[model samples]
Target: MMKNNQPEVWLRGALPDIPKLLQPAAHALLQSKEEVFKYTEDFPEALLWEKPAGRASVGFHLQHITGVLDRMLTYAEEKPLSKKQFEYLRNEGVENPEVKMDDLTHAFSEKVDEALKIFKNTPEAILTEQRGVGRKQLPSSVIGLYFHAAEHSQRHIGQMLVTISVLKP
Candidate 1:
């Protein structure tokens, strides 16, 4: 249950200085961050890579949450993905025993911080500006990218939570 009986982020009124057009995106992203941390607290490192019933591992969700935000935000800025970003994307789901749960969650939290900073600076006027996605150059706007980032992160968060619940023994 939400503390103080507060409603969802969108129901809480306007976020200071956030563009009106991007408010829902910001709310969703913030909500995703809160739930990701909540569900992953005390999650065991040993189960980080476990796939329950063929579902994606917790580690994959963690990495992808951070990476997608980075990639989408890059696109939202009308920039192409860097070689480094592509490299990170390639390695997202690969098992790394050296990676701890806290490390992945911390990285995700840092990405959320970066995203919030971007949201604060984004001009409402540029929300509809066109941007290309990936090498195919699929068209999308700044708002589309940000909204997708928010929804995509929440989708992964749901999957991760289920995996965590099933793996926690």
Candidate 2:
């Protein structure tokens, strides 16, 4: 929940231009963005990479939610992952002394904005178009990919929240 105790994004009303079927996905993504900012505001840069009990670092989740959503949206567009995308995936949880929490959070928020734009432009008729995921090209529809992106982001946010609480002292 938000620190201000505001209603969740869905209750805020339909986002302009997003298809009815895609509304839930948009809402979830927006909510994730809000929570990420809320929880990470003023968080210590030093703790960003900490992984208490072997859990993923908050930084990993921040990077991951953005990366995964970008990849999934590319799949939704029926495209293959680029070499750069694969490289990013391989480096997701690695320690990086140069990384900053603000940078990670900004990337995630920007990705969510990109997602909203995609949802707005997507014709409802095309939401069901068949798409492939990863090298295996696993079967999924456009809407399926979008939904997965939304849900996957939320799942990581929850995991990140747990790590944040545990490490916050």
Candidate 3:
């Protein structure tokens, strides 16, 4: 159960081993992870892919949060997406009978952990260095990519919560 009394991750003070410049991004990602689990804790698997009012399903939000983080982190490292990464992106909203809310939420949680490890190891100096995003190679910096990933995760979490509420009995 989530403890409502404690402050959000950003207010919990600086995380150890993360660079000062990257702390907010890390905090945001951590908060997103917490919110994802909290909102989906009692969500029924039967409604995981339900799209109430034609909004994106909760399952897609969960998967996209995880997959986008992976892709963004890869770009931050100045790398291209692998074949498997592209495959994941293509299937983001497609539902499978095997997928459950727990599995999707847990994947997002794990992706956040992976992101933290990258943030810890990132050199502060290179944060502002330019990097490219997507096939068009739109310009962005390391910090930009990381911050986008964090903010994007938070956005999807909010959408997922609304979808879950609409679908819940």
Candidate 4:
């Protein structure tokens, strides 16, 4: 919960200069960031890669929350995925015993910070500008990409929370 005790981000109202249309996205992203930290604060590194019920692992969710935001934001900027990004995508769920839970959660937090910076700089004038996604070049608007980034992170965070609950004693 926010300091004000509000549950939902939208209840916080408009941010200083964020575009009205983009405020919800920013709020959602912030909310997801909060939830990620809350759920993973004491999560065990040993179970980070465990997949109960064949669901995606907590580690995968952590990596993906960061990766998807980066890739989708790149696409929103009308750019193609870099070679490094493709490599990261290919390695999403691979277990790394050395990776601490703090590191994974921190990476996700940093990515959200980066996304917010980009979101603030995005001019409302370009929200409707067309952008291409993936190798197939499917069409999407700037707003569409940004909104998806927020929602997608939330989705994965929800999954991660469930996995954490199941794995934690």
* RMSD per model, one decimal: 1.8, 1.3, 1.0, 2.0
TM-score of each model, in listed order: 0.93, 0.97, 0.97, 0.93
lDDT by residue (21-46, candidate 4, tens digit) is 88988898888888887787767778
Off by over 4 Å in 4: 1-6
Q: Over the stretch 76-153, how does candidate 3's per-residue lDDT look in tens digits?
A: 988999999999999998998898877888898899999999999999999999999989899999999999999999
Indicate the TM-score of model 2: 0.97
Per residue, candidate 1 scores C-alpha lDDT tens digits across 130-167 of 99999998999999999999999999999898888899
lDDT of residue 90 for candidate 4:
93
For candidate 2, lDDT tens digit of each residue in 1-169? 2467668999999988899999999999999999999898777889999999998999999999999999999999888999999998998988898888988899999999999999999999999889989899999999999999999999999999999999986
Q: Which has the higher TM-score value, candidate number 1 or candidate number 2?
A: 2
Estimate candidate 4's RMSD in Å. Answer: 2.0
Tell me how many residue pairs clash in candidate 3: 0
Angstrom error of the Cα, residue 11, model 2: value is 1.1
Displacement of residue 8 (Cα, Å) in model 4 is 2.8
Name the lDDT of candidate 4. 0.87
The better-scoring model by lDDT among 2 and 4 is 2
Worst 10 residues of 3 by lDDT: 1-10
Clashing pairs in 4: none
